[model samples]
Target: MSNSNYVLVLFYSRHGSIAEMAKFIARGVNKVTKMDVKIRQVPDVSDTTTIASPAVPDEGAPYCTLEELANCSALAMGSPSYFGSMAAPLKHFIDQTSTLWLTGRLIDKPACGFTSASTMHGGQEQCLHSMMTPLLHHGMVWVGLPYKNKALISTTSGGTPYGASHLANSTNDTTLTEDEKALCEAQGQRIAEMALKLQ
Candidate 1:
């Protein structure tokens, strides 16, 4: 049951910003020798309460399997902000993980979170924290951007000491700065390193 080569970068992207961040994080995971990255996405929730998203997503990362979560060496989660919290679909997806919680499947694993918002102050931090709650219940060791990441002190776009984030705009801009990308990679590398050592 021991995995020495993988980390799961799981996320939900409504308008594509958060998905982009997840890729950057995965790229960082690939920077380490013998490390592997699995990108997983959650299915979109339907507006009709009685209906459900298809079992498979049409594009982007495949829907996450609970087994993937249980077996991954570490987790990097993301979501777009929905008024100071993660979007409903991502939250709903995480809510379905009770089996993992009961078995402590993710216990002691290194975890980090990321988010994107429509404005500069559109509750990015709150969304990151909201996403972390479930991981906390699973006994994850939380990781955040450290001062040593370089981007923490010089970023103008979407880097944060709390976690990596992107400023998706009210004007519909979705570009990530170099700093944001660097921070995302740094977070990934940091968690991957911790997971490998802890194992």
Candidate 2:
């Protein structure tokens, strides 16, 4: 990984909702002066024990490398809700970070998480927390949105202190509510600021 100042916006999106949220979050990260953004995604996991995906994704952001994860100044991770937790693909990608953990490559870096779910009660916060656990174990600082954002108090769709979130509804909607968008942007900006301070 190049020694550059950037926040890694990493995620897995099966239905495009989390992908859209990643872009909005990237926009927020871009707002931080002098900080760049690196957006990456992980390929799907296959149960057949064959090559589940190509070495490179056909489109969208490139797959994340262990070096990129270890070298990033900060991270904004996301996933579509899977049974009140992060999807397996993202978890699998994170599971590979054991090497980083052994070396303390991610120690003290700032990290945060986000999620999107099919229902208002579809465990958005739980998914966010699930994603945070590994980062916490890696010794990264966890950043969270505060209620001062105002949107967190009024969002009927998705917004939380744990992190940014979206209620995609039953059809896997990609559109975010105004509050959700603000929260996503806020999450990006907050992580960027935290990274700068931690640097």
Candidate 3:
């Protein structure tokens, strides 16, 4: 695929909710003509020094590479909430992108964030903000869900003006509410449209 035409849906999911959200976001991106979506995930971080993650994941999306990241026309990133911040694994992957930052490869590319939390007050917005910081530092334009998206105002589970979000409940349910899905799609579509205009 041509690097210039695709949006990278990069994420890290612990209980799979974030991954499911990535799919809906990709579906929204697919609605736009002449644009494509690439879903990729980062490997889990291990605490043991001797442990090493496999080059390819045993299941789910393949690991993302720096090249794929630098070449995307836009980016949609997600991660499960970890203490009011992004999970360590996604942050680990992003920390390695100093190469892209130094060269301004992602400069002006449209980007958005998505996240999931186990409860209504589980720091979903803070996690989204954490994810957006590195993107902003890379000179990428940040895109956010607007109140115009009816779901953002109506959602009880997880929609936010900051970005798409999901309330996973304490049981860690991965199923997205209708409103959550709608906001995710809107976020995706908005980023894709913005990417095209910037191109």
Per residue, candidate 1 scores C-alpha lDDT tens digits across 93-132 of 7888999988889999989999998788899999989988
Clashes of 1: 0
lDDT of each: 0.86, 0.91, 0.92
The clash numbers for all candidates, in the given order, read 0, 0, 0
Ranked by TM-score, top first: 2, 3, 1
Error of 2 at 118 (Å): 0.6
Instruction: Identify the superior model by lDDT, candidate 1 or candidate 2.
Output: 2
Q: Which tens-of-lDDT digit does each residue in 122-152 have in candidate 2?
A: 9998998999998999999999999999999
Candidate 2 Cα errors over 4 Å, as ranges: 1-3, 48-51
Candidate 3 lDDT over 148-189, as tens digits, reads: 999888888998888999999754699999999998999999
Off by over 4 Å in 3: 1-3, 48-51
